[model samples]
Target: MELRHLRHFVAVAEEGHITRAAERLGMQQPPLSQRIKAIEDELNVQLFRRKPRGVELTEAGRVFLDRARATLAHYDGAFEATRSAARGEQGRLCIGVLPTTLFHPFVPLIIRAFRTTYPQVSVTLDECMRAEAIDGLRNQQLDIAFLRSAIDEEVDLNAYPLLNEPMVAALPSDHALARSGRDAQSLSLKDLADEQFILYARKLGPSFYEATMAACIRAGFTPRLGQEAPRITSALSLVAVGLGVSLVPACMQNMTMNGVVYRRLKGAVQPKAVLMIGLRRGDTSPVVRNYVSLVRKTAKTFRPSEKEAR
Candidate 1:
């Protein structure tokens, strides 16, 4: 009926002697024998037969012994699992990540390090848009999210600014800037003033969309917006084919599409894309707490290496 009863039953069954079973259980012989009798009465079946020197298990006792042992084992496992969860070593962590931020070095570094540190925690990644990431955090569907900006409207949503990576220009392989030896070193935003630009819709990621437009405007020209795509990666693909050029997060340079070359921007003030982690204000789950802590530590050490993506 109870875990202690199952344990007592198993110890008695295994030892096959009342005195020995009590010694194994660190209890008295009389109390152990009475506990075994109580189990049979509670089950409404004869589980043991008295013998001259010891007790013999009846057929019913053998069956009950198996069940009792199995029950005790399961109880032990459940107890340990509960402790593990309390320790933040076991649980599910659902993360909603913006598509644009998903491939960044900061994002993956946190995920890999968290996975290594809490191997028992289940980490689920949902690659999503900025809006979806916000919604997931607000609705409690996601434990945390990685994105370009923090949604300040929701009082319950807490944002931690991770790192800022400079936006670089994605140029076509045969484009003038890519081909020019001097411009090849670094290109200014003003250099792309006359070229057509591919812009992904703001709804896909408003932070990226705004950063691109703002950089171009400050450079002294309203960029000729020629093509529009649903996503930044799609816009980059368009740029690869000479349709247009686009500004993207520096970390995105790792995509390595054919005909696409990434160049640093040169200026006193350059556009910077930010990566932020958003979470609910009062989430107290150990798994979530561990992830947030790991994220902060990782962001501190995140350095963009050419091979960090690999």
Candidate 2:
């Protein structure tokens, strides 16, 4: 029998009369009686006993009522859950983030805000390189990513700028400039002319590496490249070991590497560490949209500017 039959049976059982039950259900007495009959017939049992005064429940009717009530409660709960998901109040979101993002002060702030706002929604975060983040977004393996901007135009994704972090120079504590007291003030690229440079791997982003080289060229002489590291942390670690000085995002300053000191760089050509929120081109999940919005808001509150860092 259909849900309507169970509902009608329940109404009749509660009202103790078909005529009154039909009035309560906004229907005719005959149809309500027929629905109850259909349910009993399907179950092959009598669900009620009729007397001149009113109707009473049979032993079978008492057991069936409990089952019907439970079924209705289950349906109500399921409907509520589906509606919550549709409204972005519940669901799972997987986000891929660049390793450098963890160094940014605002990343954790945004995560905390998102967790508080959507307590019921499950969030999973993965630290990935820029290329891997791009691949994850394209393959639908991640709902969104926080990464550097300047993505390829051909990728099927949408990116919104989250923050712009200026680059800083990480120097060895005992280096000449560090000894001369010149490291405390904002430094021009010219100051690094005689210093050996540690470079980020070319594979990370050729354009970014090239930008660093260009900045050095504009300063007067090409920086002497002494070593290459695959990630920002590795580059800083090399600097800490007195391998060579390197220019890195200002956010890296938050990391305390022994013997490594961060100095502000001077020049009109500030290489920015941009944070972007990326999603598949056609993603329509409400949860993803809400998360993106929250990220944008958080970014606005704590976003760094080139002049501010300088």
Candidate 3:
């Protein structure tokens, strides 16, 4: 009727003698015999053929032995699964990232490391806008989000700064500046004042839009705003086609977008882009804690000359 009874039947059936079975189970022989008798009475069938020296399974006992063993195995596995879930060793992590965030090496590198450490945890990665990523965390739809650090101002979420790199100019390969003799040297932000700027749309990232615009203003002239894209990487595509010049994160230079070139920008402080991890406030899940700890460790070793800007 219960798991203990199944285990008792299996022990007696396997040992072939009630006295020896009780010894193996750390119980007395008399109580073991009574339990066996109770099972037979409850089922209205004889489960063993008793002999002077030992006992042997009846036809029905052989079938019941197989079922009892299977039942114990299933219960043991389910019990372990519950413990694993409580320990955070098994479950799911739903992660969100902005399209441009993954371009930074740290994003994928940390994710790979986490997967290696917690192979039992399932991870789901999604690319989302800043608003969507924030909303996902608030609604319990996301466990973590990699996004621009500008969102650190958000009161409802906790954002950890990961990387900070100066902004640079993205020009069409055929543009005069991309081909000029000064290409090897950094240029003042004022140099691109006359060119139409391919801007990241303001609605998707208001802080990014405003910071870029403010940097241009400090350069002595407001940039001529042209085509707008949802993200800096998408803006690069427009720059490649001569739609307009763009100011983007220095790390973006690693993107192998054909016809696009990155040049260092001088005197543009506010245009710098910073990456951060955003999580819901008061999240105590160990899996999320483990990921944040990894992010902190990885962020510490990032050097400006390596895996980031030049």
Estimate every model's Cα lDDT from 0 to 1.
0.84, 0.82, 0.85
How do the candidates rank by TM-score, highest first?
3, 1, 2
Worst 10 residues of 1 by lDDT: 301-310
lDDT of 1 at 214: 85
Q: Give the TM-score comparing model 2 with the true structure, all chains together.
A: 0.81
lDDT of 2 by residue, 1-310 (tens): 7777778888888898888999999999878777787788888999999879768899999999899988887888999999999989899999897877887777777888988999999999999987888899888899989877666684678888877778888899877766655547568778888888988887874544776798888777888998888888898889989999988878887788888987887776566667788898878999998999888877677845443366
Model 1 lDDT on a 0 to 1 scale: 0.84
lDDT tens digits, residues 189-229, model 1?
A: 88888999888787767787788888888888888888778
How does model 3 score by TM-score? 0.83
TM-scores for all candidates: the values are 0.83, 0.81, 0.83
Winner of 2 and 3 under lDDT = 3
- Model 3 pairs in collision: none
